[model samples]
Target: MKVLPSIQSPRDLRLIKKEHLPTLCEELRRTIIETASKNGGHLGSSLGAVEIITALHYVFNTPEDKIVFDTGHQAYAHKLLTGRQKAFGTIRTKNGLSGFPKRCESEYDTFGVGHASTAISAALGMAIARDQKKEKSKVIAVVGDGCLTGGMAYEALQNAGLLRSDLLVILNDNQMFISKRVGALGKALTKLLTTKYVQLAEEKATNFLKRFDELGNNAAKLAKRARSILFPGTLFEEMGFRYFGPVNGNDINEMIEVLENLKDVKGPVMLHVVTKKGKGYKPAEEKPTKFHGIGIFDVDTGDTIGKSNSVTFTQAFSDALLKLAEKDKSITAITAAMPEGTGLDAFRDKFPARYFDVGIAEEHAATFAAGLAAGGSKPVVALYSTFAQRCYDQIVHDICLQNLPVVFALDRAGLVGEDGPTHHGVFDLSFLRDIPNLILAAPADENEMQHMLKTAFDANAPFVLRYPRGAGFGVKMDDAPQNLEIGKGVWLKKGKDINILAIGNRVHPALKAAQALAEKGVDCGVANMRFARPLDTGLIDEALTLSPRLVTTEDNMLAGGFGSAVAEYLTDKQADFKLLRLGIGDEFVEHGKVSQLYDQLGMSAGQMTDHILKWKTK
Candidate 1:
């Protein structure tokens, strides 16, 4: 009765009869939905991938046979089957089962993955290693059509083809990435699947096989070869992969049979398995994009719970960008498959011609935006801070080197709760600081954000606006956007005993810390140091003249970040001031609530207050 509870590992799944797998698949899907409703994670993709994962475990000898997951969004079912069932409820929590497959987390997780388009390479590497060591275990890489669109995936494919490695690449054609699948590749898949050729071939094969006796197997092979000629995966075949069916991935038995047939079919086999994004759940099936990486929801009705009431920084950026776009006809909006996440969907709808959703290719988006800017267009590339890392080369070579006036609106620029170390945008400030002709601005609240957005747009350089995730400080917003002076810091509160210079979300907390310090008879001043790159040198000089002790805090890494910039500037100036830098530390932060992480990592107001008080007494 309890198929999931009885299962402890992949072996237990292998022990189960083929007739009982449908029930197991149902249980797995429900478990994912229920767990995600409580813990909140990548729900839709995982739900869709249940049957694939189930069949893989049933067919392959995992732990010995390596199975690599690309991006790890669809591996929740894999995690559930691979001895993580008991700890599954605590996933993406402070200290729990990881949302993505991590090698350190389990033996079944052959390679740790968070980002996309790396699975084929990793699996190929493992396959090469297996061959070198003369091992017998099979190596498989599960990649989505989304991952295939990235340049890296193709590069790996080309390399794997040359090596002619005994690797199996499963192309999970779900027809959806985080956003709807884009580009020519997705279009090709759509075209190949929807054609009458596949239907006619299947009908003819089935009827002919029915007429015959146990020669159906022979007829089935003939049908497959005929279908291959009619509706083929030519792209994969050209890449040196022996291409297989566009199989019904939802049918567990069918997948098991197909995988069984291909188990020993050597030298780079490509199996295209078509699956629904949200197969079982009705609500998720209808609105799969919204359910992709969702917050906690009521399991019964599929309504999301625990949404922040106040206006978020993303909303502020969207509103500001919308207003900016209305006046500036030259302005163009671009996102790397994250129009909804980056709050650019509204803009995309409002200005369809100007907005470009460039699929999950961040590098292309960056270079493309640069091209647009070079062509006399004001291109605004709105990407998450974490994903912005992918386009570093493009940002430097194409955008910054050319000195293009492209606005990089980096939303989720600070600690993103639950998603863990892989998703946090804390390193952007450090990485972008040294890039020449780059204007880096971090706003303190919703009001300052609007002004900063305008300021970036009005500037003639590679402007970067970094803002945190979740709700804003609910400050009074101005109707008309005002462009502020570049490379300047504004005083939030003035005092004489100590100087607290903070950026972005840390500014509000630093102000509270200053207040708390004031209660202890420690007169502390707070300044919203809006820009990270420009340093606000005059403000630092002025603050030092007022107070002997200077403290710099930011919602980023300490190494080469906002505080590091301040530290380097002060060192160069030969300023004789006791300085303290507060931010994320040397280690990768674990998953938790943002506030909890702040407290743990010593970035919270209370923590800041304590650190400052200690410094003052010393």
Candidate 2:
């Protein structure tokens, strides 16, 4: 009989003979590898985490015993086991299974997660709720060594330590998140992996538990001292958690046995398990960083099937920053544990001392960049637009309010294809625009992105340079980056009938739209409005003189964003023009191709053209 198909739920998994568990693990791995090879989801972490999820489900009554996952990078196997095996193939697709654990999707998913370092906090809350209800159900948080680097994780740890709720915080140490891990904490974790105490602890685990019962108070204190010899003991123990073994996380049988032993352990216990990312897959094992979040790949050879030579906006930003850094000694690149994702790996490689990977700490990255700026260094904090929300207060108080010369390079700024609403960069313009000293610019193409970098560097104040994901417009880059006039926009085309004011990723489409409208007897023009803040009313005023009909388009939200800024400007001047603002609406956009989303939102070249052709006569 087929092992995986035979198992329907956690209860079914528990019913399997213990000796056949390894066969089940292999089946689970094969299913994940084959499914992800076609679907192109999280590979290294999820693949490695199969045993941990399986062991948790097998040992605990899952819907009753809650398991919370951090970031959901490793939740693929969790989804598979939680009655979602039949629908697992539809992940990251239109109207399909969510990439992350969604509360609405399954009763087994105790807590839904997307962002990092939130598992411990959410699990602790669930634990407290269970205690208050007089329930004995266990609550466990599956966190990576990487999630531990984020400040919020430490804060949650501190709170959990004090609360002393019946909790299990499993630190799944694989030593990498997206890219190679960084900082003192990573070094500490790496050291802990090689220690003999962790291995010994597993060997004498049952004996040690028996000793705990027999020993007097003095002998129990000695046992605690012995545990302190291990690396993470003091760190976790000092926080009031009873720490447990560094067992093999990839070993399902070992994890199940260890978990069953610790299931009833009282008051904030932590089980430290060491697993390898891409444990069963050779290609991912060799290069786990590249396979962290991958596209579709060949299962046999472990190569990404369709590779493109096009330089993405990330690469463009990285290349421009490198060139800029070559001349300026003070230029420093910083990211929140994302060097490869933000294209800062080359910068980190070239300028080791100047680069700072703060390790999944966005708020700290912002404030740290501010500190660097204060000490006479030009710091550029490169972060995804979605993650930037975590540090809004820090940006406002530490950087913008103080008028620090820190460049905030907001990457992946609009529809980030399959990552969905949580990862989109649409809100940056609206939030950052209202900040007094901050200057926000959205580049039209790769060349303009370079200029925007130069423009941000030259400004010597709080600045934001936002750009979209995927390949740039394929325009030739300038040999020497030029600093453009701040708050000014350049006119790409001029027409007598209508003016299409566009910004960022929407510019090229707007240009195409203007041409399409012209063929359809609507004389439309396109202007690349570079700065969303200083709405280019000089160009808008010029365009208003030619045509009373104006339309504003941006990749950002329509409310309080680029389009809204344009409307606010025109309305302030009491100008008489039939304005049609085009961009993302009030609803949260779902995961799909960026093109599909753009067309759906009526921001595509054809959609923009069609909408403008039917505009009311002035």
Candidate 3:
């Protein structure tokens, strides 16, 4: 009678009574909510996907039968079912189960995924591998409708249709992705697919026709053909997948039945399952985006556990952009599936018509912004630093190459904690710096972020203004956004013995370090070097006058980051200065709080001051 005890794996799940599956779904949802509430993870998506995941594991043979989850955030339920219940307590903690699926984490996790829209390609690869090995295993890619907007998913679909391989592509339609999904294609597809009820007359006619199969074979074939044509191009079918759903994802029995039926027969079929973003959770359902990714929140109230006293760089950018958008009619904003996370929800509300959310399609969003920019409208594409990597090509070919003015407001531009290496924004400076005709600015505080936003809008070339994830240092907000000269730096502290230049979130810490050094008779000059691309040569020259020992600090990787930019500039000018470049090392940063990681990496104010003091004594 106990479903939990009998279900050790998918094999065990297959033996369970069909009616008991609903209870199993409830258990899985309960486990997810409890574990995610305590550990802090992607709660909304996992909750939404509970029944669908359970049905897949129940109906399909897994481990041998590949199941690829797009973005991997929705795999918590999958992990629990596959002997990972013991490890759920340590979710996202050091040496624990990952929040996202990792190939190394489990044999059941067929493909490692952190970013969006990769399931189709990953599952297709497994399908081809299965064919080569002469294996009869089924390959299923469960992707969110949001992920479908990504160009990579469509590319995979195009190839899948061409090859006609045996595969099952499940479209988990939650009608949301962190926030409500955007783009006309996603909405049109949902409407056409979900709203289409099987006609009553056609069903009755089919039943009647089957009675005289011997006499009506040709007529039945014609009727079936007619039905397929009349059924408004279910987007996936147009792309070659045999369309099959608009089924209720939350119905455990229905899901199991649908999945079981589709298991054996398939040459790239799509099963569209509709789900609620926060199914069964009252508060979460009411406010799906708030619960999408929480940080140790109160389960009952769904309120965030602690208050962030400092104003975040994201909030500052949002305020500045909204103010600018109010005055500038041509100004428009776009976020590729990230509105709340990027703090663009305010801007979206202020300018609904001007705002565009292109779902998770970063590549399209980048090119779309270019088109807007080319058409004499100012388009600002704001996204997370890690997600910004996905659109590098478009940024080059569409925005940078043509030298259009597209402001890229890059949030979470440094070590994003808890989410680990895949979510870290440490590599943006390295990647964006060398891109021709691109201007990159890293702001020190809230005021600087506002100023940089204004500056980015003014420059009219491809501009990237990066800021970190967490709250800023509660710096005073600018009364009105002011444009500064492009590629300039400002000195925050003046001293004679040592010169410190810090970028973005590192500036505040560097200033504190300077104050610490001042007490020890080691005078330090600090510069809030806002611009990373155009290293302020004047500031560098001036710093050299005060001290031969120049230290550049940033939250990025030490290699090819702001520090390297400074070192390269000095080398080109043939200036003599001993440099200490402090930043994240080449190795992948592990999951930890941002402050703890900074302390461990010797980037904290006290740690930096200690190092400099010890160096002086040496």
Candidate 4:
């Protein structure tokens, strides 16, 4: 009856009878659902992968036999079985278990992964290591169909095909990649090749051919050959991997059989397994995206608890973009595998033909947008701040160099909470602001985000509008999206005393600091400085008039950020002012609540005000 307690590692699992694995899988699914509901994690993907992970670990000798998971979101089941059951309660917490596969966490985790389409390459290296050592161990990589769209996966596949190394690639085709998969490959395979009806027909034909002894060998072989040509497996075969499946991924018995058959399979092998996301849970199965990475939901009702009263920056951009799209037919949106997470699901739905979901290929998405822009269609590619880093070269060479009008809306542009350094969006400011032909703007509020988006779209050069994660201050939106005087900073408060110029989300906190200082009989001037690239130089000259007193605040690193830009401007103008730079210092922020991180960095409203009061007194 005690299933989870018995298994310490893969070695312990091998001792168990094969028939008992179904129960173990059931327990694993229950454990995943229960833990995810409490701690909040990749629910649907992890739940869907319970049987597959269980079967793989049971069949293969892990720690000896290497297994790599692509994207790492679906590795919860793998993690749970690999002596990490105790740490399941603290998933994604500070000093707790990481959400993704981390090499430091366990010996079983052979490679660290957060980004998509990397499993094949990592597994290939492990396989190579095994071959060089003359060891008899398996190398398996479990990747989603969604990650297949990434160019890296194919690149690795091409190499694997050429090398003919013993590698097993399990394609977990759940018919969705965060949002439903886009592009012709996903459509063709799901619709025509791997359809349930088509697979059933193929199975029936194969079984029927086996009855004839004399003719069966040739006839069955011919039918099998024809099926391969007609299906998506041939595509993988052409790439140099022997292909199997369209197998039922949820069925423990079926998965065991397929994996067992492929244990001794030579060279590269791809087993395409069909699965339903959120297999056991009804609510998750119905609306998997909403529950993808949830936060403490009611398991019985399947409804998320404690809805935030505040609206996140992502929601504001989504709303603003939808309105802009309504009026301008030329405007279209694109995301690299993130539709729901980036808040572009509504836009994607409204303009199905116009919208593009270019899987986990940010580089391709950037270039594709350039091609779209060159063709005269206004393309707005909204990607996460961290993910945006992957396409920096493309932005510089393909879009900015060509002077294409492509607007990149970067979400979570600063220290994103909980997911830690890997998911943090801090580097975009340093990276994008330095680019030569690109125009980069960081918005202060919801209304400002809308206005900046319009400005970026209209700008002839490649542009980026970066905003931090979480809710805005519910600022009233009276002004519609308009073309602003480029490189402008609006003064929020007029004072003859200390000048504080802040960019993006830092502007609001600086305003609060100014108010607190005003209460303490200290007059502090405030400016909501919008553009990071073409900064308001004239305003900087005026702010320096408040002599021997000024400060620059930003939600980016103090080095090579807004503060550094301000210092550069003053130096260039030969202006004299004792300027204090306030921003994240040179250190990687840890996992915690957003507010806590701000407090730690001394960037909070109270901390800023207190510091200013002391500075004025001295």
- TM-score of every candidate relative to the true structure: 0.92, 0.92, 0.89, 0.88
Candidate numbers sorted by TM-score from highest down: 2, 1, 3, 4
Local accuracy of candidate 4 as per-residue lDDT tens digits, 17-113: 9889888888888888888777777889888898899889988889888899998888888888899888888887766888888888899998888
How far off is residue 312 in model 4, in Å?
A: 2.8
- lDDT of each residue in 1-618, candidate 3, tens digit only: 557656667788888888888888777777788777777889889999998888888787787788999998888889888988777889887667888888778899888888999999989998998999999999999998889888899999989988899999988888743223323444344334332243344446767887886767667657766645634335676677777666678878777766766676547878777799878888789988888888887777877777698888888989998899989999999999899999889988988999999999888899999999999999999999999999999999999999999999989989888788889999999989999999999888888888889899999799999899988898778699999888889998877999899998989999999998999889998998889988898999999988889998998999999999999999988988888889988798877777778888899999999888877665
For model 3, the stretches where C-alpha displacement exceeds 4 angstroms are: 1-8, 176-225, 229-233, 613-618
Top candidate, metric lDDT: 1
lDDT of each: 0.88, 0.85, 0.85, 0.84
- Report the Cα RMSD per candidate: 6.6, 5.1, 5.6, 6.3
In model 2, the clashing pairs are none
Between candidates 1 and 2, the one scoring higher on lDDT is: 1
lDDT of 1 at 516: 95
- Ranking of predictions according to lDDT: 1, 2, 3, 4
lDDT of 1 by residue, 1-618 (tens): 778888999999889988999999999998999999998899889988899999999999998999999999999999889999999999999888888998889999999888889999999999999999999999999998888778899999989988998999998888743223333454355445434565456557677886777798677657656645744576776677867667777889878877877788668988878889888999899998899999999988989998878888999899988999999999999998889999999999999999998888899999999999999999999999999999999999999999999999999998998998889999999999999999999999988899999999889899999999989998888997899999999998887999899999999999899999999998899999999978899999999999879999999999999999888888998989889999988988888988899999889999999998887787
Extract clashing residue pairs from model 4.
Answer: none
lDDT for 111 in candidate 1 is 90
